[model samples]
Target: MTKKKQNIIFLLVVLLFTVVLIFIPTGFENPSLHKNTERVKAVITAVNNSDLQNHGIVTTGTQNLKINILAGMHKGDTISATNVLMGQKRIDKIFAIGDKVLAIVKTDNQKILTARAEDYYRISIEWILLAVFALFLIGFAGITGFKALLSFIFTALTLWKILLPLILKGFSPIVSAFAIIVLCTTVIIILINGFSKKGLVALVGSISGVGITCCLALLFAHFFRIPGTVQDFSETLLYVGYTHLDLPSIFIACIFIAAAGAVMDVAMDISAAQNEIIDHNPSITTKALIRSGFNVAYPVIGTMTTTLLFAYSGSFMFVFMVFMAKGTPLNIIVNTNYVAAEILRTLVGSFGLVLVAPITAIVGGFIYVRNY
Candidate 1:
């Protein structure tokens, strides 16, 4: 077969494999009953933000609602459920006082109450915004932007639909995370560069970098004496009967998953730069191509180091400030799980960042340049 046809076949296989992975059963022990209890259509009565007496960011917002219990045993009961907004920092507005919404209802001992936030669809605005941005990107960058958007969607879907489900199903979180890293890297690289030698080189480099990142996260997470419970929402899952879950391994998995995108970005950048050097100077020796990789990797390394640092630091700035205000010692503060996790994340990812240069340089130089 011709090179073009071979590339096409390779992409089809990868796409097919990704699709299959979505249907793979995750063996989660606890299965929730597939049931919707009751429907409560409630209109928000008033919306106001009030300050909590002793809390920093906590606010007391009340949702006064007129509820029509439309389904289940509570059918025809026109009751009012008042929801108090605790200081939980959710992505949505957590029910404004006057925002009309629906609720899931459950009854016990003749008391009918709201069960869940069935009407959390208020955050559809974020989805709408993302859709508009995707369209704008497609319009501006044309085909390249469209491929980028697809890569973006695949990244999000694989994390949510594949990885999360597998983890909840009691699958080995490390293995699942590794599989996701490979799948995401392959999808994104091939999508961006097509199925050429450049894409292959990028795929190898990214995989190697992710391997290094995983090893570092495992070693350091163990060394630092941090527990898996450091990860947010872990305890909550345990309370909900997912206590059999292996959380430390999952925590380790999260480290690389978070770093995978940045590592892939670095690997592709260096590999592409080396490829350009070879194309421009076809006679350029492998040594020169390797040097070109170094040239590209250095700036990328510096920028990415800060990129990871700031990305992590921004989220924890408030916690840092709280510690500082309380006169907590730097050593103790740094040793806290919250602070230590960021340190591990930044350092392990940086190690991968450091290692990608040589991997991409050597791989791109030898593979694309026809050196044995």
Candidate 2:
């Protein structure tokens, strides 16, 4: 089949697969939480903050709000709602008049009983941002940009539909994560680069890097005594009746998944560079192309290895602040469970990133030059 025809056919198949994934049931639900509760978009008509106390960033007590349901069975109905603040600056919010909110209302016999403000109504704004992004992407890169957007959607859906559900269903998290990541990487590369030798080269190299990262995470996480509970909400999940979830294995899966993007970047870099070299000099030997791939990879890997550091450090900055604020010793801080986990995350991920460069270069050498 023609290359363009092949790409079109593949795209249709993938689009169908994504549609199916969207409707597949996750098979898990919070029965206690959603019982008899319906959410509605509301505009706060009035607020009574007389019962609330403010201490700079931290606020305690409650905001009693009058909200008008916007688009539901109770549309045009104004109801009293409570917005509670627990003094946790991070998660607590104080609502005010004229603010759009999502209020979960309890109903009996088609009459609203009570409403609780869940969060700000940002879904509309979120869509606006996404629309702008999609326009700019397609405007700049045309078909390639559209394909990139499709790949992005595929990745998000795979994680939400496949990975999360499988793990929640008590599947082996490490294997589930790896299988999902590999499938994502393959589809993403194929979508962006087409189904060709270069795409295959990239996929192999990326999966190789992911494998290395997973193994290293398994080893070093154990060595560093990093606990899976270091991840946020892990304890909450266990307490919420997923007590059998393998937290440590999930942590290992997380390590590779985090690194997989950078690994793919490196692999694609080498594959694309090698592809260009082979295209320009079709007679180039495999040995010369390998060297060319390595040359391109040298600078790319250097920056990428550091990118992993900055990314992890930025994510872990809150932990750093907490330790420094408490005047914790550097030694004690580094040995802390969460801190150590971050360290293991960065190092193992970087190792995979570094390794993928050579792996991609070698793979590309054989794949690209074999055509000559």
Candidate 3:
């Protein structure tokens, strides 16, 4: 079959898969009581905050708001809303008159009992931002950018629809994650480089890196004695009747999944470099092509290894600051479970990046130079 027809078929399959995922139930819908709670777009018509005073501080406090619902069953209805302030800056919001917001109206037997301000209605703005991003991506990279966007959407759906559901349904997290990573790597490489020698080299190298990372993560996580409870919400999952869930294995799986992107990147770099070399010098031997791949990967490996360090450390900057402020000892800070987890994640992921480069180089050598 022609390559053009193959590309068209691949895109159609991806689109169909995306549509199927869209309809797949996540089993996290609201209960029957919440069924009467309608999220509606509302405009604040009035705000009365005269009775809001907390210890002589005029901070965020309760405000009675008159809201006009613009959508849902109670369209064109003006209802009273209570904006409760919890004194937490992140969750609290003070609404001004004429401000548009999302208000949750609770009803019993068709009678509105309470209306609460949930959040600002920002979906339009969010879509505008997304549109700008898509426009810029397509404008810059053209068809490649379009393919990348499709891959991005596909990866997101696969994780949310397939991987998460499987894990929640009691599947082995490590195996599930590995399978998803392999699927993502294959689809993404093919989407970008087509189903050719470059894609094959990249897929093999990426899977190899993921395998090595997974094994190393499992081995080191066991020896480090860091309980899976170190992960946020892991203990909560057990407490909430999911006692059979293997958190450690899930944590190990997360390590490779986190590194998969960088590993795939390194593999693609080596593969693309080898392809370029082969195209330029058709007579290049396997040994010379391998050397060329290695040359291209050297600088990339250095920066990509540090890339994992920066990415992992960025999330823990606040923790690091807290430790420093408390004057914690180096050994204590390093041995802390949270700190140890971050260390393991960065190091093991960097190891994957380091391994994928040479692995890809070797694979690319065999694929690209074999023909010559």
Candidate 4:
């Protein structure tokens, strides 16, 4: 097999091994068991006909359901679930009279199954969407697409199965974020570019970018005195026994991790630009090639810093609107920890974007001159 194919196979093996080793110990297979409640397979019978379901969505407007439960203790039970109109008008799901669905039967402590149609229908839809995306990727990029898909899956599974758990276990949030970032960077870059000078340049550039962002995040986080609780769901986490987790540090870490992708893009762009210059003019001096990288990075910096700014600002549009409506004073708005946190996030990420150019230029210059 060719070098690229070999590298792809090796990455797949490593990804599979990492996932199995990291997730299996977490007992992710078992569903949570709640007191006085057990999940059962149930089918929908009717919609909105009784007080028991006044709060339920009317799927079929009180029509009788024809779907039957297909599994568990209620394998053959037939029930009706309502297709309530959500009235928000944006919701597209409209349940029909004969649609099969899984219904949750709330027993005093154990749930019996009622309907299975909705669950099956949702699963079918999910599969269909997955198939469409897979086909699109395969059609567009072929083997590269396949490798990208694997890398995407591995990154997702790693975050879900390993990183979150580690954070919840009271591990240092910065340490966990860095560790996950390293793992993700390695897998994603190698899967896409293989183990070559180009990949090494991208890795080095991305890491340097992340490190710069992390430091900026820390310094500004302290300067702004933004509390970690500015993050939504952070308090929820603390209530769940992760009180030891430092929210501010985690927030800082997340700034870098979030910017990592953009930084990698900048790195790869410069690296590729430098590579093409070398390939076309193999005798170009290293200094001249480095200047070429700087030229590419300059335009990239302008666009990407704005990209990060808008991305961060978009999330706070509602908050800004609320402050405006309330006629909140500028000082108050600026002093709010939540607003300050976002400011830090934006500036820190922008700093990373700014730093990526120099790092990538240097690394790409060396790689281009040495490799080509």
Give the top-scoring candidate (lDDT). Answer: 2
Which ten residues in a row are the worst by lDDT in model 4? 51-60
Per-model C-alpha lDDT, please?
0.76, 0.90, 0.89, 0.74
Candidate 3: clashing pairs of residues? none
Better of 2 and 3 by TM-score: 2
lDDT by residue (tens digit), candidate 3, 1-372:
988788778877876887788898887554885787888899999999885766543355688999999998899999999988877766778889989999999998878999998888998789899898888988999998988888888899899988987887799999999999999888888888777888899999999999999999998998887777888889898887889888888888899999999999999888988988889899999999999989999999989999999998898899999999999999999999889999999999999999999999988888877654
Least accurate 10 contiguous residues by lDDT in model 2 = 26-35
Residue range 1-372, candidate 1, lDDT tens digits: 787686567656655655665575544523344243455455544433343232577555555555555445666666666555665666334565545466666655657645443464344577799989999999999977977886787677678777888888889999999998898888888877877878888899999999999999988888987778988888999998898899889989988888888888888988888778777888888777877887888888889877778888888899999999999999999888879988998888888878887888788888877654
Decide which is better by lDDT, 2 or 4.
2
Predictions: Cα RMSD each = 4.6, 1.7, 2.5, 5.2
RMSD over all Cα atoms, model 1: 4.6
Task: Superpose all Cα atoms of candidate 3 onto the true structure and report the RMSD in Å to 1 decimal.
Answer: 2.5
Candidate 2, RMSD to the unseen true structure? 1.7
lDDT of 2 by residue, 1-372 (tens): 899899899898889998887887767756877667788899999999999987886789989999999988899999899999989878888887889998999988878888999999999999999999999999999999988888888899999988998998899999999999999998999999898999999999999999999999988878887678989999999998999999999998999999999899999989998998888899998889988989999999889999889999988888899888999999998887888888888889999999999999998888877643
Poorest 10 consecutive residues of model 3 by lDDT? Answer: 51-60
lDDT of 4 by residue, 207-276 (tens): 8888888878878778888778888888998897777888888788788888888888888888878878
Q: Which lDDT value does model 1 have at 368?
A: 77
